[model samples]
Target: MHFLKAATIAILSPLVSATCTPWSTPGTCTATSSSCDFYTCLESKSGCGPTGYELGYALPFCNAITAVSSNLSVNGQAWYSATKLCLQNALSVEASCETSCTNIYLNAFASHVPCYLDSGFCELSGADLKVFFQVVGVAGVTSNDGLALFGAVLQGCVTKYQNGQVNMGWTKWLVRTLNGEI
Candidate 1:
C-alpha cells in the first residue's frame, strides 16, 4: 500500500501543483513575488521616455503577439498590428495628435483607432494582449501610484484570466477604449 501510494503521489504531483504561465496583465502581476512586475521594475530603463516608465519592454511582447496572432487566427489583422505598434510605443504614445498629455494612452488609443472600423476587432483572445491594454491604459496614470494598490489590481486580473473569467466583454471595452469612443 505504501509503495502504491508513493507512486500515485509522484504521478499526480505535477497535476496538483500546476501553475499558470505569464500573468494575465500587469495588474494581475501586482504582488511582491509576481514575475509580472517587469514593467514596474523598469523605472530607469529609459523606454518609458521622459515620463520615467518603461514602454520599451512592449517590443518583445509585441513580437511574441505578432506570432501568436497569426497562429491563433486573430480576428482583425490590421488592428492587431496597430495595437502591437501602440504597445511598442506605449511610453510616449498619446490619444490623439491634437491632444497631448504625459500619458502614452492617448497615443496608443489614437494609433489603434487609425486601423479600426465600425466593427473591426483586434485579436485579444490571448492573455498577453489583454494585459497590454490594461497596463498601457494606465501607464501614465499609475506611474506614480502605490505599488501595493497596483499589485492588487494586477493580481486580481491575473487570477481572473487564469480562471477563464475574461471574455469578449473586456476585449470589446479595450477596442472601444482604444477607439476613443468609450
Candidate 2:
C-alpha cells in the first residue's frame, strides 16, 4: 500500500504542479512556482523563450517577431526603414480609403484623422520614437492600456498632418510621444 501510494503521488505531483510557460498579453504569469519567468532567462543567459514564448503575438521564440518597427522622421523622410514602410502602408491605405486603421481598435469617432497626405511625416518627425519604444517595451508597465494608447497617439499625429495642421515642434512632440521617450 505504501509503495503504491508513493508511486501514485509521484505521478500526480508532476501533473498537478505543471506551470505555465510564459505570461498572458497583459503579462500575467499564472503558473506554479516551478514554472520559470521567461524573462529570467534573458538575465541568466539560459535561453530565449521556446516557441510561442518570446513575447508579442504569442509566437514561438524561433518564429516570434524579433524586431519591432522603429519609425522615426528626422529630415523630410523616415529615419528608420520600418518607419518608411509604415509611411508607405499608411499612404497606400489612405489612397484606397481615406479612413485610418488603428493597430488596436479604439473609438473611431473620437479618434483623429489626418486630412493631408503627409500624416506619417508628422508622426515620425514630431514624436520621439525611441521614447515610445521604451514605454511599450518595458515589462509590467501599464501606461495606458499599452497598444490602445499607442494607436491613439499615432492616430492623432497622423490626423494632424493629414489635416494640414503641421507646425513648429509638432513633429518632435509626436515622435517623443509615439516612442515613449516622453
Off by over 4 Å in 1: 1-57, 74-78, 82-106, 109-119, 122-182
Per-residue lDDT for 83-108 in model 2, tens only? Answer: 32332232221222222122111211
- Per-model CA lDDT versus the true structure: 0.37, 0.33
Candidate 1 positional error at 93, Å: 9.0
Give the root-mean-square deviation of each candidate in angstroms.
Answer: 20.1, 20.9
TM-score for candidate 2, please give it: 0.22
RMSD from true fold, candidate 1? 20.1
Q: State how far residue 161 of model 1 sits from its true place (Å).
A: 25
- lDDT score of residue 173 within candidate 2: 62
